[model samples]
Target: MSLHDTSSEGRLQGRPQTGSQPAIALIDGNNFYASCEAVMDPSLLGRPLVVLSNNDGCIVSRSAEARRLGIAMGTPYFQVQRQLERLGVEVRSSNYALYADMSQRLMATLERWVEELEVYSIDEAFGLLSRREGEDLSSWGRQVRRAVRRELGLPVAVGLASTKVLAKLANRLAKTQPAHGHVFDLEAQADPTPWLEQVAIEDVWGIGRRLARWCRLRGVADARALRDMPSGELRQKCGVVGLRLQQELRGHRCLPLTLVPPPKQETCVSRSFSQPVRTADALRQALATYTVRAAEKLRRQHQRAGALSVFVRSNPFNGTSFYSNSATVTLAVPSNDTAVLLAAALPLAETLFRPCHPLQKAGVLLLQLQGEEQLQHHLLQPLPPEQQQRRAALMAVLDRLNRRYGSGTVRWAACGLQPAWAMRRERLSRAATTRLEAIPRVLAR
Candidate 1:
């Protein structure tokens, strides 16, 4: 629990003393993935629906109706196959493009309302609220709720607080407690102890299982007890991080809203195939596609991977002949160039692939990532400047065309034409909301 930079923490005026206004709000999309599915196709409304993970293996997102019927999250689709059919449950494979577009729109709407925003995840964000004379913070939070609902057709819960930690706790309550308005204000609480006590020690945002165990060993059972413990004692045990969470529990600002996210240390693109692949060539096809995806992400982020790893595995469902292997290739020069990545990756995939066992999945991982500016040129093995520039320009053009038209509008032949190892999208929802050409048609009188 190392502390993040708190340079922009608290309110503009500073941490308010007694009876001050709320300064932080945690905005979270309700049932984000399921909601995304429902909003795009209103026909799913009030229906028992679950979005499956890659390979249609398991339920990753379930609508409220599906949950009510005891369809547990992460339950393998096979395990619940009979229940789903009997209950007339609808299924959709995850459409990340649609979800990502919706998330971008949601965050864009949020940015317009806040002074500063920290996007915590695809479905959660922390927004800073500036104290204003005659401005009701709670009302402002409510407006955010309304705006997202009306503009994006997305349901969100707002949790207003004096500190980010409390704001997170408030948001948790807003989600769990029916009595709390979709927007709950923790700053308004004269004493947060009672509410904090109700929250489990593990449920606090930063308190993971190890921390929870440590707290229990020290006789600090719940968040309230943790807050009541001397700040110095916890600091001694967990260093500055423990002290900060302790202070945050007592309604003090120790964590700041981050505007810029730290770059990913590694980029991985992988997925299970629709069916088992027994041939090395099929695995090569899968690896090439994943390499393209991973490299595309690396280039888009303005970073280059110094090492590439190729991994393949047999189906977990098959106990016999179960095999998985991975191999890593270190580059002489770091690059985001797709050609460079594929050249190294295909060879590794060939070595890692075992022809005897059928592969359920294959993947590519780009490691030792650094910004493009940090790349060091090899003294003797110099990449030709003219050729490099041409490839860069070509990649840029490819990305632009794909974005403007649709994904796979332009793809490398190495990825194979009609890859048989492609993941199943038999029950995939339409990307009407994301793709320019897929927008739904309307019938008029």
Candidate 2:
């Protein structure tokens, strides 16, 4: 059932092909990070490109040409440097700022075409497409792709089907096969199962290596096999998710096409080495740096922590001596103020520090977190009015400055020198908006 062999007997699927019924459209931008790079530099068009992780460490995404060289994701840049150079693969670091800004613009652009939109990933989104009088949904998909290209300068592939799962499968086919790369509509065929059967189980959504093995054990090897399995059995084995997948495969629309908001994180911090931090001071400095970050997150959330925990550990997996230590301290009063939180935790860090064990990682954690509330004013833990006022004023100014400029625009001296703890990302795209220099600018000819 290849795209090239469209025969007279194929016809279309028995499902209603009219526009009145609900149809799901899954949109995926091709080689998203590489596309991000290409959008910034038009010279990158049709060129081999690879994007690296933080600190220019390893490959994260590669263009089609680069992929043809057998380079893989997470392959250390140093390990494949010669091979990449020989293949002329352009490299860049993980420019999150650039990628994030582009993703936002893409979502905003899609908002114009459909009534409801669900952004699944930075490069993937789903929308409900309804037929207008005498209008073809396939043609509409081309228009959506054109809009993204014209407005955002990024190429996209679209898949249309009766269900979200089918739409996603169509999207995958649209990517692998250039003919379907532009548009894939399951309703246009009498039977899409033949095409669906070609997709491997592991490639399907929610079926990772472990699940794929489990599915293989049950003789379900492809999308069609899993689709045909009894829903009751799938529910019993894989729980609600497997049931949802079963329904989606059967085009029953069990899963809602919904946008996922960024999740609320439980903790936030930055950690680094001391002397290249082969010592306790380096570990302490790293912990202190993260303490500021944790406190800032707490205040930003309008919350406070009742306890602070500091941890220091050697690089265990690096074949070094295993040394790990951690200490937790209860605060007299829950507070988001940096001075109060750091004051409570710094002493604890000292207690947790090992004697010159070449500390590799250190971090701070805030526990028993709660939103700020009107205090009962405990007499035993009362702070002097002037001291409290000073603390509040100091933190306010620090937060303002950091927000206006950027993180680490100002830092407490105790946090120590920035370590090479950051993941290596050499071929990084420019930070399109964060720093003064990294902002994308229009150059007048």
- Candidate 1 lDDT, 6-54, residue by residue in tens: 3444222222222334488899998788899889898989898999988
Runs of candidate 1 exceeding 4 Å displacement: 1-22, 132-136, 214-219, 230-237
Candidate that scores best on lDDT:
1
RMSD of each: 4.8, 7.9
Worst 10 residues of 1 by lDDT: 10-19
lDDT of 1 at 73: 92
TM-score of 2: 0.80
lDDT tens digits, residue span 107-176, model 2: 8777666656898988888887565443447777878888899988998998888788889898888888
What's the lDDT of the predicted structure labeled candidate 2?
0.76
Worst 10 residues of 2 by lDDT: 9-18
